[model samples]
Target: MKIRTIVFLTLFTCGSLALLVGSWLQVIPFTLTEDLGFITGALSVWLTVVENIWNFPIGIANDIFFFVLFWQAGLFADMGLQVLYVLLGLQGWYLWLHGGKNKTSLRVSNISPLELLVLVLITGIATTSLTFYLQTLQDSAPFWDALTTVLSLVAQYMLNKKFVENWYGWILADLIYIPLYIYERLYLTGVVYVTFLVMCLFGIRAWLQSRRAYA
Candidate 1:
């Protein structure tokens, strides 16, 4: 890694640890698990923006943290989504290392129009079905939760394949998540989603530049 990247990661880790400590001590209003999820989630997105392979491992940790947090909050769909994220993260880790032409490192690329259409259709169907299922369980914000869940799944899959369009899906989901988290009284998590919304823009720009460089 470059010196600057190393310095950034070190500072980010230290800052996250400080937040975790503060939350644990009740100096911060968020729960320990929430703080952990926020730290890992934010760091993972930042690393993804830079196309860092470390994002996958950090993201898996983030998924586990959020799974516990969401389960406690009764966001069942979101809780289930975290399990899928862990699976996707592991796949992404390998693909980033070698899922390319002849076992080479993957390169950023665009999705085809047909693929985009298919993903949209799939997301819509999944969200509708999940929303109904969550409603049966009396979940709060069932539709919104299902929408974000499906969108995130598609985005993560696209990201695993190094598709430049993944950021768009993430941006959409984050926008929905911001208000949803706040509505659930997960204020810190809402703030994290707001940060995610910004990081996703950078991800789009960075990945586009990477794709152009490859070309």
Candidate 2:
């Protein structure tokens, strides 16, 4: 196996173990009523740090933790999105390896004005519809949860296609997510978003560099 793949697996195992132990000890709270635990929470935060930096492998880890945290917090939209994240992760990993012209490595691409408009329109519509469902059924922070879910769909899809604008979606989502995660008492995830907020800045810069280099 590749060295990066091994490392990714190691980190994923460690992170999962940490979460399991933390949950057992009540260190990682899975539900809204539960408070955060230290070790498991920290593991999750670190996983996000890894994911933000080198996403292909780390993305697998993220989908795992995200499923647990969002489910616990009643953020069903995002929780369900985690399943999509995993599927998209595989598609993204393959594309990154062999989706360029003539099956070359993938390079970052630009988002045209029309594409941006479509993404915005879709996200807005999805967010609005989901907000109503969440408000009525889950009584959760409907708008914020729905917002994250919708934007994540756009961001994840864009990233899979190697679009530089993907980071912008993450930055926006992370800003709203910090507060929303904390409100749900998924404090570790809240911290993770803060980390994502910072790393997304770096990601945008890196991808822009790739754009020039690959162009």
Cα-based lDDT for every prediction: 0.94, 0.72
lDDT tens readout by residue for model 1, 38-100? 888999999899988999999999999999999999999999999999999999999999999
Report the Cα lDDT for residue 88, model 2. Answer: 84
Clashing pairs in model 1, backbone N/Cα/C closer than 3 A: none
Q: List RMSD in Å for every model shown.
A: 1.3, 5.3
Please give the distance, in angstroms, between residue 191's alpha carbon in candidate 2 and its true position after superposition. 0.9
Best prediction by TM-score: 1
Off by over 4 Å in 1: 1-7
Each candidate structure's count of clashing pairs = 0, 1
Task: Estimate candidate 2's RMSD in Å.
Answer: 5.3
Model 2 per-residue lDDT tens digits across residues 87-157: 98788878877888899877778989998999898988888998998888765787888898888889888
Cα deviation of 130, candidate 2, in Å:
1.5
- Residue 148 alpha-carbon offset, candidate 1, angstroms: 0.4
